[model samples]
Target: MGIITGVIGHWGWEVEDYLLDVWEAHRTPIILATSSILICVWLYLYFSEEREGLVALPRQYTVETKRTSPFQLSNPLPTTKPKVVGEKATTVGPKRIRGEIPRQTTQKESPKRDGLEIQVLVFYSSLTGKTEKAVKDLVEVSQEEINGAGTGTCRFPDAQILDLSEIDYDEYFINPPKREDGKAVDYFYLLLLPSYNIDTINDTFLEHLKETHNDFRIDSAPLSNLVGYSVFGFGDREGWPTEEDGYGFQAKEVDRWMAKLTGRKRAFPLGLGDLKMDGKARLLEWSSGLIDVLRMFAQTGVLGDGVRGSGDADESDGEYASDEEEDTETSIEGNEKPTKNKGSIDDVEDLGKMVAPSEKAPLAIDFTTYGKSKPVNIQTPQAKEMVPKTSPTYAALTKQGYSIIGSHSGVKICRWTKSALRGRGSCYKYSFYGINSHQCMESTPSLSCSNKCVFCWRHGTNPVGTIWRWQVDPPDLIFSGIKEAHYKKIKMMRGVPGVRAERFQEAMRIRHCALSLVGEPIFYPHINEFVGMLHAERISTFLVCNAQHPDQLAALKPITQLYVSIDAADKESLRRIDRPLHRDFWERFQRCLEILREKRFKQRTVFRLTLVKGFNIDEAVKGYADLVDKALPCFVEIKGVTYCGTSTSSSAGLTMANVPFYAEIQEFVEALNHELNSRGLEYGIAAEHAHSCCALLASARFKKNGKWHTRIDYDRFFDLWEERGPDGDWTPEDYMGEETPEWATWGNGGFDPRDTRVDRKGRKIEV
Candidate 1:
């Protein structure tokens, strides 16, 4: 080893020098060749690893083993652990690392079942707890009725009652709830809603339904999954005496919304009840009807014949059609049979031999007469009854509280009559005229009308015709029938709470007749005779016409007052507002105005202008003033349109927004009065009924000394009518009553002082 060390020491310097020279010369080439070789080795290693199915570990998963000590014992654990059997393995991949592991699909498959079990959900909204109590009673009654229905293919479980104020709208309204146990189940919704003028949960629920229907992201009818639905509403009749006055308004709105949401699956017509009077009875009746409908659905799975399913909104409880008549008409149209000859041919002698026997002869034409002569002994077609008992029109009118009289006439107890009986107040007629509301009989001789006004509270249920073509009932029969019906309806109100004993007794005897119940009173062929019949009984007559029938308006009748409905001030506006059926409606209206001008001295002429906000209120002052100047009526009654919660109105784009507020009405009235006065028209704002949103403008002729004399003297009117026949000359001043009441005058509110005003909850409202 020493000899080798001495030799290496001697050659070390020479070997180091030789190596340094070789390194300096080949440095560049050596670096290039090494890089190339390293690259080729790396490519070959990568390809070999790929072929062996090896993958580079991600940075996050790269394990760095730190050796605490080089001498530390080698870990005994294997790098790859064996998977345990029956254990849910953790997902380990790009998807898992990116947090995108697939989730179970939300799309659920409907379970197939043998039969449908109907689950009835009774929903209610109450403000004063009255509806809550009613709902409890209804649920109990419904449960009993369903239990009594016996077992069948469709089984009904216990009914569920839900308070609308507490329920989540999205859970039920957006789509029907899914059964957790996966059974074929159908749901029926029954809503009991109490209307309140003030804010309530009902408004919020209604808004949700509207938004859901209008939402673009959802189907327009999301609740179409529901089998059926119905609604019953409770309201205070004393505060809101009519549907047009917001009685049961919320319930109606709910029914309408449900109809839309359920694709017109209104299983039953809406039932409205007066909370203080027939609320329970109506609820029971509605429930009974609903139980019948449920049975029908279970047995047939169809809403019976004549029942509107997925169609128009139901406006009445009953619907009927004359199948026999329809079949006959269809047969006649299909057969095309030749009409029988009315008379013998005049030229029969010329073709005596050629003519066959009379019985076997073909329909012969009379050459001499040709088409110039009318057919002799040709029986005229029989006139049809205006409102048949089995007709839809009759059912609709009865449902709306009208008692039909004769075939063509009807009599109804006005809301004002009920209010007056309950000492709530009277209609605007009572404020302008001295007619006792409870003692007034509101009747119409003809139920057929000429116009379908947009503000018609009847919801297009009343029949419309351009002419009187129905069978005419005798005037005497109509008069008596109307009186009996009126008295009967009034007597039915005897058990109603808050009815004054004296007022109830006074209502038994009719002191006046209001011919403005529904239709154009002048349309009755025997209107004059009918008025005479009322006058004979000392009942003052206030006949209102649509002003479309000029001949009837001009023909004759002197009564307490004559009203011509001036719905619009211009022709185009009239067409839009009145929707008159007559082709020459404007001419007829102008002629009626001229007739009124001519009859101003003979009868108490009035122009009743129903102001619909957007349709006729804007820029209509001067036009109305011109009409007044042309007619020179004794008084002009201006009233805001009453909003009827009807599909017809909704389709016409009319809503609560179109309803003018009392303040807005006052502004319009004031503006109209200014316009009239500026045109030298001696008309003044004589009185106002703020409660009814009505204002009266009287002519100077009604002004006695310094006070306006607008109120009519019923006794004096009858006296004048009896002393001088209807055709006799008479003036409006002849039967003028005392000066207008102080409380009824302009700016005094026009509410009777004796009656107390109450809020919707029956709390006395201090004026």
Candidate 2:
């Protein structure tokens, strides 16, 4: 300022230093950032790149194909989806492996396993009383073999039929035939016979056929896949030559000892006949010509590549060969196309031949109503001279065609039932019921049954019959009353001959039915509302109670599927396979398994255990593990009881028909299913068909993350079945192929329904 004073005074102090340099150039950056003066030297350092973990790439892993049945799957499906690098050449036109493709493809079909599904059983056996009008015309030609035209089941997909007097066949070989929440059985169609004593054998059919000829592993390793058959012996002509229907000379010496135990070959027979008096019209024209040639050899397989099946016991059923075109004019210069095609009765001794009789035509009767130009209801010589003899439509039903009416053919006459086991002369195959329903859907219609199983099949006496026995007939009036009592039993059978008036009116026509027939039919308080009105018509029941009705199955109402029938593990083998009839039947059979575990439906709950070979196949694994611990059930089946009718008249009065003691009680129930999966608890023999039955199921897994696997939800058992709708809507997308239960990551991971990467006995290992 002094220098300024000197200057103007030197220019008035340069105008106050240019007005404080414009106020310190906007206040000197706020006092030089508040004191660049108070600060000095200092520096800090650090840096980063990481380039996303240095350029990644590489993954790969595979192997899939979990899909299951419904005609089996897989064309492209090995299961994968990261497929992003090459699909749009302007919309699906190019790329057969263009870019991100390492590629290798080959599996357009044939990993193999699925092509199996065909079925048909058709059995028949009657114990005189002229085989009850040929068991009402072979239950109307075995319900016209699942009907659809040309007795060959039209397109034939899964056929069936059975009725050796409503069989017990020792619990269908040991297992299959449960229900009531023990879920076992897997569809059927039987009418087979030869479970022995030929029906009236005596002493309860021979004490249930000497307990089924002293149990010889039921009869041959769970009946080795049962395959198809067509035997039809009934009796008389000194029962097929006597000493009890002279088993066609011991089945032609047990078919040369079963060709030394199955290396194949040997089958064909249709000779013997008679369930009583003219052999029920030659077994209804030989069951309408063996259900028209085993329903075309049970859906094609007339044994191709040069078809040649016929192992003669002396031929004579009309000398075999004729795939039919009005009984073949002898073609075979080239194979004529026409495709095709259960158990026991002491296993067919070289079986074969039985064709002739009702050869083809007639079989169609699925019945929603197929009166098909109706006619043959017949009987009127003045209405058969005015119906009488036991009046309820009689005069011995006036040579059939029964006219004394318009109503009342419901047929229920009753008595001759109370069995306790006694026959083993051999015949045994009976699984019919389907005329309208009753058995699993709670079969009351023929009145209530409370326990009278001396090794039952049906026709029990005492408590008397008849309850709802009507509205269900149509498979052609049970096949026009069994093709007019088997065309008056093929004019009294004898020397055979007669039948092909186009296969003897296809013995009228009927289809599958098997209410487990015999006693304790739940005890009929309208038995579970007639099993929900016979599963609303799709029909597939298999009921078999006898826990003396566990208070009528806890006052009825909860039976779409459930089965109790334990047959002894305590209370003295339940009185040797239910000889019960009250005394509080084992505290009402453990209170009907606590009312089948507090009832609920949608099918699934089973326990069946019949395994009676010499009274309880050696402690049947602590009697089926205390009936699967009071019914945690979903199946247990283990069946094996058979010796035949009245139980071969109750073991031919104890002289026992001898069958290697029912094959050592079916080889100790297959070591009680491997001692119930080595005591841990998992099972699955599921329908072996029979040597005396099996069927297990339930690995009961699915615990969640911690691990364990296959308690088999199998997409909920392939979308569950058998419902008539009481409530079981079933959803999981109805299963088949990969409909997504998805989450199956499992490859080398860990989850564990017991960690079974393979091992259903197929065994593998990775853990």
True-structure RMSD for candidate 2: 32.3
Instruction: Write candidate 1's Cα lDDT for 169-220 as tens digits.
Output: 9999987887899765778898988888888798899899889877867767
Model 2 C-alpha lDDT per residue in residues 1-767, reported as the tens digit of each score: 88766877757778989978978777967778656644532211111222322222233322232222111122332222222233311212322211111111111222332233334444444453454455455656566563432233223343444444566655553323344675222222333333244333322423443343235544322222233233344444553553233643332322222221211112222334544455556655555554554444434423111112211111112223333222111111122322221121121110111122343223222122211223333243322211124432232222211221212221210110000000111011111001111111111223225454545533232222212222222333432442343232221121112112222232222111234432345543344545544433434344666555455566664333457777777887666555654554576677777777665233445677665455555645766676666665655555565544333335323113422243454465456657667776665332222222332333333223433222223223322544323444642223212211222221221122211232222234343
CA RMSD of each candidate after superposition: 22.3, 32.3
What are the lDDT figures for the candidates, one per model?
0.71, 0.36
All candidates: TM-score: 0.52, 0.21
Model 1 steric clash pairs: none
**lDDT at 210, model 1:** 85
Candidate 1 wrongly placed segments (more than 4 Å): 1-379
